[model samples]
Target: MSTAVRRRRALTGRGAGALLAGLLLVIAANLLAAPILLYVALLLFLLVLFAVLVVHIPRRSGPVTRRISTDLLTVGEESQVAVRFDLRALRIPHGIWHDQLPPAVSGDATGEFPTDNGTSIRYAITGVRRGVWAVGPLTLHTIDPFGFAQRQQEFGETRTVTVVPEVVPLAPLSSNIGAAGGTAHTSSTRLGQGSDNLSPRFYVSGDSMRRIHWRATAHRGDLMVRQEEEESSPDALVVLDRTARRWERQGPTADVAFETAVSACASVALHLVQEGYGVDVLDSAGTVLGRLRGHEDDRDGLLVALAMVRPQGEARDIVSLFDGTPPGPLVLITGHLDEEDAALLRHGGASAPILLMTDPLPGAAEAAARLGWSSAPLRDDIGAAWEDALPARMATGGGHVQR
Candidate 1:
């Protein structure tokens, strides 16, 4: 509860008119020497004063509570906000109320305060942008019974709602992806092994002597066991190049192109996870932003991470994100790809890799194609890039082979 009360009082239209009239009457009384006119002026002045005092009197208000319908909100989605406060602390007056909303939110925040039915009010708001938005400081506007004066009082603290990027649906990975040497349908061979299919792996603490592969151990000169890990899932990677030089910034968030890239990254990762692939979301500097391992995992966490991602870091070669290993279902979301950058990325082993660019400089697309990368210009229709790259991956040979 806040003991501090901030109040603003002002005269209504009628009160202003009355004060003007009282001034005129006082002038007339001085000119005409009529005591009757002076009496009328004094009454008018007192009435205006009384109205002001009625509205400005200090009054204590009870604590206010606010509640939101959902824990998180997605862009363009609506959420309900409910407010409750005590009405008995002061003599209620007929007035209107408004809830202050940030620019990122859209909705009607004003309504009649102290409804005849109850002491609570509810309003709906739609998230217009991605980020944390504060919606609060309910303000009550009261008018005197005679409508001569008005008062405004703000109550309660601010509450925040997180809005995440919209995740659009993406087409399934092309069937030819696996044939082109992508591990989209299977786990990375070097990372883990399947229980149903026996494979060699380093011995763990609980490994049984019966499951040891002595021949493999002797060949590798290290103890190996046939990993029976049932929890292992196929891995995929979504590399987001947010280097500041590559994107345009509008403010704290990147421009529309970067927003599209973020959404594309989210959609691609979600699609892969639904298709039974463990997805790792990485930035341009080889930093892992978020990871989704199982189909049943909570995806909101990943979306929240992407919601806060902005254009940062200096320009660097994206090849570092591969970490010298053959990546699976590789999707690189970048901006302003040039020939020199394309040439440097050719060394990685991502068979039929998908390159989604916001702005592809002249000759950049050609170089990417020459490196066996399926390239597409990113746009509002996210699936267009997916569809365009699918056919190219289907026709090309795997692993940096020229088309």
Candidate 2:
């Protein structure tokens, strides 16, 4: 409101013809000694001055409120964006109010709104891209009774809408081999399937001896036991390569490769979270963007983070990303593979690490294969390389998405 008040300024535009005509008439009438013409010209001049004065004062308008169908929206989906004006009994007979909006929400009418009981206007807006955008600061276009002057006033605060990435269905990385009780499930599983579902608590004095987790006791140097939490999701770590290195043969931005890569990341995160998995999303820099599990809040946050992530540089630090990650199936997504990357994954402790390449590298896939990494190449039909990375049964029509 204060910003609007400070910005308010009087603009005398578009009524010059009549002002010129009145000035000419006054001079001509004075030369011709016509009192009636002279009187009319003087009256017209005075009226114009009065209108300008009226338009300049009280520059600030009333408060405005905006509402969207939902604050959380998906890319390519349409939502109604509406704004309401709290017109508190101002005698604005012929004025139009316009709200400034982003191009994504353009095409809505920003004209005169009703003032009798307050007015609201709505537009159907579809988010073209994923990211957060602000919508706000209402502007009022007020016209005087004579239609000769229009005054502008601004009101209201900024509102934000988050457009999250589209979550497409993707088959689990491995069906018969990993994560869930399967062939890939090792005997010495450090992270238990039960702990993901059950909450572990500090051991109390009366706890049963068998219930005490010796492993937790060894790790924590104190007795610990599992406690029941209504529901929890399994943990899954997704490593994304953000290095500006070559994914597709493109410039610095690498728009095409980045788009496909982001889609792949989003797909993986969404699939894991929806299917009762806590996903730790990390970039090449080992920056943990989101640790989203099946929880409602985690799911929402993961999608939004995926939508805005882009390649920062080459994701050369593989070992750094492994730090603090709970034992889980690892999915490494990268533009290309190197010897160092392959060596790191070989002994990384992930029984069968899944590798998704954004593009088909000449020898990178083979290098990873030699080290026993499941390699999947990027394809047009496949939204992400992970689709092809899965076993045949889980990759296509017969696969189960869980949720």
Task: List the lowest-lDDT window of 10 residues for candidate 2.
Answer: 181-190
Clashing pairs for model 2 are 96-112, 234-278, 243-313, 243-314, 244-313
lDDT of 1 by residue, 1-403 (tens): 2223455549888989989999999999999999899999999999898877777784736567889897778877999988886654456567787888877778888887764423788899897778777777878788877788888887778888888888887666665565333233545544343335667899888889998989989999999987544444566788888988898865743388988898889888888777777678988887777888653334777888888888888745656666566566778889988988876665376644788898998888788878877788898888767666664444653322222
lDDT of 1 at 155: 76
Question: Candidate 2 residues 254-365, lDDT tens each?
Answer: 2655566666777777676655556678887877878764567777777777767766665545655665443356677776556555555542555546778766547776
- List all candidate RMSDs to the true structure: 7.5, 7.1
Best by lDDT: 1
Candidate 1 residue-wise lDDT at 274: 74
Any runs in candidate 2 off by more than 4 Å, and if so which? 1-13, 30-37, 58-60, 103-109, 172-174, 178-235, 245-256, 307-310, 313-316, 323-329, 335-352, 359-367, 373-385, 391-403
For candidate 2, the per-residue lDDT at 257 reads: 56
TM-score of every model?
0.80, 0.72
- Least accurate stretch of 10 residues (summed lDDT) in model 1? 394-403
